[model samples]
Target chain A: MSDAKKFMYINRKAPYGTIYAWESLEVVLIGAAFEQDVSVTFMDDGVYQLTKGQDTTGIGMKNFSPTYSALGDFEVTKIYVEKESLEERGLSLDDLQHLVWEDEDEDYAEKDSIRLVSRAELADVLAGQDVLFNF
Target chain B: MKLTIQVNEGPYQHQSADTAYHFAKAALEKGHEIFRIFFYHDGVNNGTRLTTPPQDDRNIVRRWSELAEAHNIDMVLCVAAAQRRGIVDDGEAERNGKDATNIAPGFRISGLGQLVEGGIESDRLIVFGD
Candidate 1:
């Protein structure tokens, strides 16, 4: 049980524009059952996926943005958003969904899941992962 | 070292499948273990037996089948993705009420968990795609 591998899913594309973002989320949702140490990174155009308001009604695509809110239920507690990526897109933390997860060990307390970090800091996080899946 | 390769694009239009195929071949030639090769997204299109390439050109699907047979490699296509793409085996064809199946040799349909298990079991998991 202690040997759970570190798996990180790096999202670098915009959602709906391509199927990669949605399919990548599907992998994370399925991989969660294995109980590994899982995390996700949002950079480049991928930051658009976590934005607060996404209406795909006219596009005729499934609005899967709400599914991000349930990732914490699957123990995917570490959601990294690169600071530079947000800045480049002219976005701030308020533009993104305030994602959080419930901590069972702490009497079901709510804990913030999205961690905004500098690109340099994320490089260290990338180096620590045992496996990386990019989208 | 043990490795698992994930191919996310179709064999022809994109070079990811070709690159993944060559990488797997090279790994086998170097005395490495291939845990599995999971076909996902448009990658599932590589599993169709109905592919008809030019006679003078290289056969992508056949090459993959030959390599898998020679190395006894486990080639799997994501079931959900395959279903959406209409890459069905005999059982799937019957179950889904399709008249015929199009799955080629060396590939089987499975859940995304196979990829996850491969990533966990293998020494490395390399992805090739956009």
Candidate 2:
């Protein structure tokens, strides 16, 4: 087993609706800053957070999606997505910028790198994690 | 694995129930355990049985009941939130002289301390919100 403990964060809601996602991200960032291994899985509407062309200016909210890419700079690189979520919303990996997405249907088990995982794989991911935080 | 879910939205008012159901189902499938599901703020609406959504739409109350029954999940609603929202059980309803009670079955009303305990006890604390 790796010495680094893994943390999984499952985000299902949209980013702007509430502060849950923001608060959760803050917590995770702090954890990563402390040198903990961290991973994030965005599903349902939460996937929108990873899309490249975020324009929150109209709503007067500062665009924070860019901060997501910065997570890699902090060595928190395990970002996952649900395949059904992408297809259900007619999205693809190209929609995201600066980050790689795991396509669940292509590799539900995530054998290679941080692959996309099905609903079934979600449990396995949750099981292996030392810390799992949902937002 | 012991999972603690933080619920922010009321039952049926948003996608909180569906998200919780998905997580509960996945956790059980993996043979893991759910430590607790802490309901807070607007999440206390999950206990209200007074909802009557359109027939075409999903029945959140029934969905939650089925999920809890099948997985034996511990579903707790915030008591303070419930009381503030006027959702009471038979005892509270009678004491307050309400004509009817809105709290749903299989949902226990309790305090936020339970939520804090849940956060501390569980291996993972997942939050489902709007």
Top-TM-score structure, candidate number = 1
User: DockQ of all candidates, in order?
Assistant: 0.77, 0.14
Clashes of 1: 0
- Sliding window of 10 residues with minimal summed lDDT for model 2 chain A: A106-115
TM-scores of the candidates are 0.98, 0.49
The most accurate candidate by DockQ is 1
lDDT at residue A34 of model 2 (Cα atoms): 46
Q: Best candidate per lDDT, number?
A: 1
Residue-by-residue lDDT tens digits, candidate 2, A1-135: 235556677777777776556655655565565455677888898777777888988999867887786675556668778878978999887786656334456673322223577867866777887766666
Cα error, candidate 1, residue B49 (Å): 0.7
Docking class of predicted structure 1: medium
Clashes of each: 0, 4
